[model samples]
Target: MKIRSLAAPFRSSSRNNVLFLSTVFLFMAYATDAQHSAKGDMATEQKIHALISEMTLPEKVSLLHGNSKFNVSGIKRLGIPEWALSDGPHGVRAEVNRHDWAYAGWTNDFATCFPPGTALAATWNPALAYKQGLVLGEEARFRKKDILLGPGVNIIRSPLCGRNFEYISEDPLLVSKMAVAYIKALQSKDVAASVKHWLANNQEEHRDSIDVTMSERALREIYLPAFKASVMEGGAYTVMAAYNRFRGEWCSENNYLNREILRKEFGFKGVLMTDWSAAHTTVKAALTGLDLEMGTDKKDYNEWYFADPLIKAVEEGKVPMSVVDEKVANVLRVMFNTKIFDEKRREQGRMNTPEHQQAAYNAAAEAAVLLQNNGNLLPLHFDKIQSIAVIGDNATRKHCSGGLSSEVKALYEITPLQALQQKFGARVKINYARGYEKQSTFREGNNSGQSGSLNVNWKLIDEAVAVARESDVVLIFGGLNHDFDTESADKQNMDLPYGQEILIQEVAKANPKTVVVIIAGSPVQLAGIVHRVPAIVWSWFGGMEAGNAVVDVLSGKINPSGKLPFTLPVSLAQSPAHALGNFPGSDLKVNYEEDILVGYRWFDTKKIQPQFPFGYGLSYTNFSISQFSTDKTGYGKNETIQAKFTIRNTGSVYGAEVVQLYVSDPLCSVLRPEKELKAFQKIFLKPGETKTVEMPVKVADLAFYDESKKAWNTEAGDYILQLGNSSRTIFQKVKISVK
Candidate 1:
């Protein structure tokens, strides 16, 4: 069966029955194909072993460490090419110096900047992620890079985490589903996709040294799923070790995480590399399943931990020669998988093409979440309004150049102001005002000046207010910039910096037709203006075509479909991490006090109302979910629960809705969350169109990690499946028994 065709409607039960029969036949064919593929894989593994046999010990050690900033040493005599990696989770980062962080100043390195991780997650469409990955892989191949160090899947433990923008979501299932599609697409072009931050590298504060402690259940259930899926399902070729320590040991040298979980449990065969200067010891790191050591900040390459020290350790009988061979084998395996030895067979990619730009635009357009449309003051009709007032510094600031490692040298970045002027310049008048000035500047690994200043410039606010008063409609683009969203440092609080709260309040008071467009990657405090603004749009850090995408959504050219990947708490104090006062813990030690209760899980279980719930977004059109039912009332532990539901687009427009399936075990022996997201599907429909959506949930997936028994347990009891657009908006519920 074609996976893409699964989105099509099944009008009757008979059609569904036919589809199920077809699936059975498809599985039989797939099994035969898998056997043939297994034979091919074994041959490839034998070839990799043969290549390792010819390599000298010194040559093998050279392959395990970086010889330059972004390259691994290769033996020219053996026809082995060097592995080049690019820093990315969004787009191909500009080329840096061979030995330093300075740009190489290459004019040809410009790339098509795509939306960041949070924006892609908001789309809730894995197809778009696959498309974006294809673009990224093509560009990486064009740049002659073998590995794209990207698609960070770390759980969004706290909104204040500096790298949350790089991560996908708080929910493991959402992150897993999106990441698998991206990795599969990227590797299809012969470029390796490096799934990162192997363990809980949640917060950036003291990241290089912080020791993280969490329960086994949290590690197995909350953190490990996405990484496991990335390796097993996505077939990722490389993994990046996080800077932070897991349970008192640096992730680069953690045996339980790297060897036991990643290599053994997940059966990952790819090279595991460090996150730049994360290596702690030579012997420990090499023996713990670290295949490569990259960017250790040493001026002399030979002095790096995995270089001379590793060689010395082996010669002194401290680290076995067999360990060296194992590391060499892992590196050669990825090299063979990516076809590095056969340059003629590898993909010769294209850069900054129209197709790549279109993928970026599609991601940006579908990612703008309509947080609130209180007065329906959106879809600004040109005939109804003549002049539009655009306020706030974010309206003109470009985001493609910030965020340190994820920054892309885009061919061009059109800001909101520029897009508005270009799209509506001929027919409408647009006024602009910089309501706030950025107070900080960010360099690689360093943030200078203060961004937490609450000082408001009265003169700027007055100008913004005057502009709003004269215009027929007001659009305030206010939110955190890279200073608050970049790597290395986390934001101190959820408040909007540069006195944006006061600026927004003043601008909204001037014009009741105000619509606030927040361009941020993470959640920010919206309580100040949520009640005052007529409409609110959470537009993430859109890439090159950010302006065009946002304008299309506001003009009703593209109905908004982006949803919140993480819950927007009314206050930071309400978040599980902060509610327990255990964030960025003391003395370089942190505890996962919240455990499996993260994001919506905590809010729903505690019954605490949030400013906005997870998987929540608004569209110009409306939809109604009805006729929800399950195929069976009782299911065995090995059975799959097939949920069937009918959704109708009742409004007079075209749009897409993400139907979320959340499962709850209300009568469990231990404490559990109110509901956990299991399965979801995004269905697009025109006006008056009805479609049947079928989502399958495995009975095994309903099990909770039992820390006492060190295994997952699904108690034989009643379970409820709730269907909804968002966590808080359950449209229907059906009960079932799992035995």
Candidate 2:
């Protein structure tokens, strides 16, 4: 059994205090259930109450914090049968095979690796994200897993955060919306979506013990929104607490957050599980609302460490039986809702269906955003571009996918070069080169490498340059690989992982007809090359079928319709979150000096132009915005007004547009952000196609956490609502009064 010493301040064990706490939980469990049943849907609570009433102390404690004994069994409560919970946002990982934990296991070689969260959010197509969720969920269910730890909704607080690729954007609104869709679709297939890294857990370095302290406003507005939305909107069935501490208390046992806020305020009626081995202690974790203790340190609950202590506390009236009941009840409620205990169990099978693969492919394709299109350089007709040169080290390597937990052990990763060759065949003479080698050169492992050494192959680059000069068009595949972006730790610099930048500059010089395709996890510093490169495509870690997807977009088989989910910083130093101080340490304090200025808000408020603004992307067609209107009284009394507009695709080619709406409150008690993302809509259009979109301005959306009032409220004021394709360009605008 695992021995846990209580953290300081929480280590109090006076007999009277223990007894008093026991009575509180005992009464709380029963009284709360009675009151809740009198008001809300009591069906779930009713069954829970009945089960708790009959359970022994050992049974109750067992139900509260232990996993299945069997490695691969489904959820079976009554016996020694094990319950399965798989690792997946994209594909399933072998939890049984311990060796594969470091490197995504080779046990399952055929699992489809889907695009990371950053890429999926860029699509701005919630339906496509949902489809991908369904595909992954189906695979998880087939693996006999009750829950899938996925759809990581943590914000990109820092550019140096190693796990940024595994997460969504810096903006909470975008993260929340995407998380909701991912959760909804995953649960739609009867698989529970375990939306994870609960709160304020951004960086992975020292994550197990690091404490994150931030303004409550920043907490509510930026970090917590995604978790709130995932639970309230997406109806997520399980929540995995992060390894970090928030506001001086470990998140697993943070009463203010887990119990008072999440369970009470957010109304998250789901099972709260700890990140693997995150549990600090049994009693403390239980009292703080930690429902499940994962991993094997504690072994079985019948052991001395758990059973003896738990029973002693209960018998002495120190720990309440009601607290145990509530935890078990929550877990049971999810199982009942998901029908995990049903008599007619569904047959376990492989989820390699064509529909699932096609869904994954579509998601990968849509997530590829066209960053720059000078003189309409993209959608190169195969016939017009007779010979194509695809060059770069990443051109043929598996550079599109990131690592740790989300990694894939695929049968094959169809790279951009291979895809180009397959798509164009003999018609295109695609030449490639390992433009640069990894920083960890074969000669020196980790210690002895010059800071700015270039590992370029001059001969190969010269040959590629010649080929590019001869070919009709050139596609230089480049960008950061999984080594540069992993959950294990953060990267040293935001510059391109290796010598790809040099290759891009040199390649562009040799062949002016070159198009740069960046397969990166996060935005990179593209200073000199932005204006020089004729066309730039931001292909963020496209999945297993990435090759086909890229080729389809390049060949004009599919119109590129992806938007930037996060603001593309010109350089890492320009980012507002840069100077906050080094993370993974409590000594370095963080301030909300930027306040609500995140993503496009930072760029707009500071008037700093990004290389490519948020929600900015190019399609094979052109679009126009017109007929803007607003209603002051349409939203009811004391509510924020409404803004509506019409969009039309003027170009002949079919495409999709992400209609973005921003709201600016002119005056407020607290210095609020200049404008916030109010609403967004994705619509498809053919030649001469047009559609009208209306956005309801909720009074709640405008509200800031008023510290004096000790509540969130919207101060009455005049607001400017703007509509456009991106944050930088507000094409249409209207005024609304909030009384």
How many clashes in each candidate? 0, 1
Measured with C-alpha atoms, the lDDT of residue 320 in candidate 2 is 89
Please identify model 1 stretches exceeding 4 Å from their true place. 1-32, 443-448
**Candidate 2: residue 422 lDDT (0-100):** 76
Q: What is the lDDT of residue 406 in candidate 2?
A: 74
Q: Rate the local accuracy (lDDT) of all candidates.
A: 0.91, 0.74
Q: Whole-model lDDT, candidate 2?
A: 0.74
407-491, model 1: which lDDT tens digit per residue?
9999999999999999897888898999988876665454444444577898999999999999999999989888888888887
For 336-421, candidate 2 gives per-residue lDDT tens digits of 66667655545343566777667767878898899888888887888876677788777777843347567665535788877887
